[model samples]
Target: MRSRHPLRIAAAALLAFATALPLAATAQAAQPTAAAGGVLYKKINSGVSPSWYTPEFERRLLASGTDGVRLPADATLPGGVTAPQAAGLVQPGIRPGQWLLTLLGSDGSDNLLGWCSANFVFKKNSTWGLGTAGHCGVVGQPVSAYVVPPPASGKLPGLYVIGKISLSRDHGIGDDFAMITISPEFSSWMNPTMPVWGGPAGVHTGDQVGEPLKHFGHGTLIGTGGTPRVGAALRWDIENGAGYSWAGAATPGDSGSGVLTLSGQAAGDLTHIVADVEGNMIGVAGTRMTKILQVAQGWTLVNGSLLPL
Candidate 1:
């Protein structure tokens, strides 16, 4: 007979070992899988928290090795990514509901990843933070105030290094939201509600079916009504726990925005848009902010406390 191939023999032995191993051992050997494109991706059992939840965010703050927790408030391209100096848009005073933007990818080939609205602002001890959809920016990514876009380039001004992202997770794909600690320099602009869009009525939880809903982003309002569909849309092996809008829908660049009831209670954050036609999109999807905060153990709302569901 021909000499047995070494590779075949090795494969046979490995298969035998695997077959003989106890089932529990095999299960224990499994690890969380990573996502593509290096956005700190992972897949977990449905409804379970992502790997970078409470502990990871806490550890990140400590890793900074600073007297106080902070993020880059001004533009300084990482990894030597070159872009034009940002033209200043921030003025003497800043307030909630104002637009914010993030530059995605390296400087020269940068994309206007996000041109969204700030949902809320919060403070803990002396630290200030802002809340937006997790999909807008990842943890430790730089953020800046909004400027006009499409070929979104040149030295945009009002350039201040916003604080680094402390915590963020995407809906469906991972966890669906993020919170950025505000740099003290920009803290003056912070507020609890979107005054420009509606009111400072404050945020609350649970579905507001038959209640009117409004989203403030892209410097305008998108309205929705009819019985809100609770937990209607799920994707990427994760349940959105989102209340779907029957009327208006969100489009690109609306991620991380809050879908607020007219009374000012935060219903959820815009995670994805289901359908669209000629500036009219339907079936807007978002993750419940209350549920997000419940899982976000170390985080609280801008009221300096967590809201009840």
Candidate 2:
């Protein structure tokens, strides 16, 4: 008989932060208005049900960050891929677990493929970037921040092209991540803080079963309203370099969310959901940070503040 439960990688749905010190919770604002800044309008099917990818839903996804841009040398790019034309200014205070990233199709079409949560901020020398699941897109696929929601005016919001998939490893459980090189035009909006929790004080190496894990994701299904999820590591797969947790389960559209230990150490990236043959949800699994850092050599996690641009 087939195993009762099977592990499934949480695919992008087309659809945060902190370690120990508790920061005062900030009220998550709804979608940004044209008055907030100019909105980019586009026409494309977002793969899934259009109703599910609405503005209210995007608001539930949470909005953060400021506006600015600057290109950096040493930025990684897939051969022959060039950055898309930059659009709307990124909101101030942009941080992980905040913006919903919509991945455009790789076939040179305008189709809105799917989306995933932004995980951590990283810097390789002077270049800054964002992290998510490798399965989100292939190398050189264009990516944009899902900022403005679908408006009543009936025009679909245009994308704020941020960068392209610079590096990715969708091999399997212990190795699922992608790095996006932020276009210099949108670089200054980067923030290293996790939303609710704080430090990610540093990178965590091994597993600590029973230790609580904290996550802040914007998956469309859960509608968290910008709140963080709390759960504990239930087990570890040493061979795969992955950890499983029961509570604080990750849902579809939550792929690539960052996971941190209670004390704020960066743990790993949530890659998939564990479920049973009956289709009952079990828990969530993530690649350990130890493995991610090892595979993503040369890139270092940015903790508190970003170095001067």
Candidate 3:
């Protein structure tokens, strides 16, 4: 069992909107299950509210540690293992649309601060990184993934430390995004293609109102059952670089999940659940890819095998 620590950070203001409604960060835990081949994997189902939700929210730390069960020394690597593998053995890769856990600090404790879905894979110079919501973590917070890669050999899936939140911002709408600098060991396993929905042909800019959008997120509360959602862009605030879409519904833990155009162009990332004055969920809102690229400067979107748009 991994040792647990008390999360020390206080909740921060989630957004700057004036709607007088509860603007919750769609970041929470989901149920864990055993993977195929008897590979023991666990989802940090700890019900801790993300630190960016509200001022009065208190942290609910997980009773058990959140570390993944380690793979054995003799375990076989997954197929298609890339070069420069760790420990002279190839391992499965981490890809977009996977579940990620945000730890409190750099000490590697199993104390889960929060969890969110990964968006896209990025490359800045030679460094690789994963994209998530800015509210998912603050700068310097450690990150991990509860990966369940395809069953290969008899090796099981478990938790792994991918990287840390090197850049983050949540200045209200259109500015909620973060970048996790991927560790060298996991770089070879990085896959740019989003699970299920393929091709994010490239970074999509400009307005796309009324256009069909596709999203694959892991919000446990949204009840997606691991299936992608399709909806239309409700509106686009071009000047502010935010957009709202009715892609079914984006709930807690869905923040940072990427959205793409039907033609497979990377559109944006889910940031918050839009609500009305009475706190009724209206739609899901996110920062546009154009804005993310603009703010996350120097980082280029890594392209994957293109699929028919």
Candidate 4:
């Protein structure tokens, strides 16, 4: 059999999602238009249909009974090999906040392939995990995140590690989202809470046009507002995919960044891909967290702990 390109796989998966509209809830949509401040908004419906994952495949995967979804043995993941961790003793930190994850290549070298974010941190059955964009890693790719270097002493720089990606939904498989299962030993370092502007109780459906959206991302390790309120409401580009667009062009490492409402509700995850015009990214789109948690069985969307904004 011939190998398929990742883009091709993503396109196929999107097509499948588009065809499965009836499976999704009916959402009121608004007309797509170019708005001020470079924000454009759109909405889409949900669906059920026959695609890559047949009724049987979906049945078994969802029935796996694990804390995470389990794929069949034959299911192919990108980067068939894992990225090797850097040699020598290193103290990397894990936290439930915006993160930058580096995707490794099969050669165990930094191919500089994918860069994304760990949107949030959550615990299931006492296990800690980080959520991110699915395209960021292969099934078992060696992923890394920023960690506070030693010392309850003076604050120092951050560190990185071989944090592995366990569960994922490739664009070709489901939506573009994945869960990075952190080791239970690293529980002290992770927090699933978020900055509160209001009640971000749990996963809620998306908003309509003119609704304001703020995306949290690592812009620069500098500046007071470096990582908050990064985007404006756009539109939902995909029909049943539950995809939403927003103003702002996402940089190379911006994928998987978490988008939220000013009220602190979860919005969606930043996709690695964006709509560009003459090399300028006009807007970015992502799979709604509501839809992701719904479709990706066993994945929980919870408000870890309430924190004031």
lDDT of each: 0.43, 0.54, 0.59, 0.48
Per-residue C-alpha lDDT of model 3 across residues 139-243, encoded as one tens digit per residue:
997677755434442434655667879999866457778999987756556778876678678877757565667777666544222336666666666234454
The model with the greater TM-score, 3 or 4, is: 3
Best by TM-score: 3
Candidate 2's error at 105, in angstroms?
Answer: 3.7
Candidate 1 — what's its lDDT?
0.43
Better-scoring candidate (lDDT), 1 or 2: 2
For model 1, the stretches where C-alpha displacement exceeds 4 angstroms are 1-95, 109-112, 147-159, 219-246, 276-281, 303-309
Q: Write the per-residue lDDT of candidate 4 for residues 187-297, one digit (tens) a residue.
A: 555545543322235764756654556555432111111234444565654545467765543433445666666566777777633322222334457778776776556
Q: How well does candidate 3 score on lDDT at residue 226?
A: 35
TM-score-sorted candidate list, best first: 3, 2, 4, 1
The sequence of per-residue lDDT tens digits that candidate 1 reaches over residues 173-220 is 324667778777555444454533444345555443444555555322
Error of 2 at 11 (Å): 23
Against the true structure, whose lDDT is highest?
A: 3
- Which ranking of candidates, highest lDDT first? 3, 2, 4, 1
TM-score, every prediction: 0.53, 0.64, 0.67, 0.59
Candidate 4, superposed: residue stretches over 4 Å from native:
1-93, 103-110, 149-157, 172-174, 195-200, 219-226, 272-279, 304-309
